[model samples]
Target: MSGKAGTETMFRFTCPACEMSPIVDAVIRADMLANGCYLCGTQVSESAFREVCEE
Candidate 1:
């Protein structure tokens, strides 16, 4: 067994418009990436999405 198992960081994206939670688990891949809520269309950054989800 490797100690590095399950050490990967995960990102949880939440839609601000419809409140669709757990949207995507692509944090590191999301860095410098821009995308909007598929459910509605609220444009937001990965970091911004994270902050909103935390609240």
Candidate 2:
């Protein structure tokens, strides 16, 4: 088995409008990714997502 089999990087997102806690396991794959926060219905920007520890 390969040693690097499970080294997927995750991202955390926080809603700017609601100031909610980091969003768990946020997967973003675009340079211009934009979405809405599920909890507070706020528009999420690319800058809001941050890199998290690899698992």
Candidate 3:
């Protein structure tokens, strides 16, 4: 097998409901749309997640 590997850029965001500052460090934009906040289970929206750079 090739030594090269693929990497998906990870994202970070806080839970607005639970107020968990940066609840995760390995989430992607798509994850937010497909799932809820991992900590509070709040319905996730695109606006809810902000790139770590925003901090």
lDDT of each: 0.53, 0.62, 0.61
Q: Among these predicted structures, which one has the highest lDDT?
A: 2
Q: TM-scores, in order shown?
A: 0.48, 0.60, 0.52
Candidate 3: Cα lDDT at 49: 62
* Winner of 2 and 3 under TM-score: 2
lDDT of 1 by residue, 1-55 (tens): 5455555455566655677666355553364245466556677665544532322
Scored by lDDT, model 2 comes in at 0.62
Which candidate gets the maximum TM-score versus the true structure?
A: 2
Candidate 1 vs candidate 2, TM-score winner:
2
Q: In candidate 1, where is summed lDDT lowest over 10 consecutive residues? A: 46-55
* Residue 6's lDDT in candidate 2: 59
Per-residue lDDT tens digits for candidate 3, residues 5-47, read 5544445566678877563444455665677876677887777
Ranked candidates (TM-score, high to low): 2, 3, 1
Candidate 2, residue 18: how far the Cα is off, in Å: 1.1
Instruction: For each candidate in turn, give its C-alpha RMSD to the true structure in angstroms.
Output: 5.6, 3.8, 5.5
- Identify the runs in model 3 with alpha carbons over 4 angstroms from their true place: 1-10, 23-28
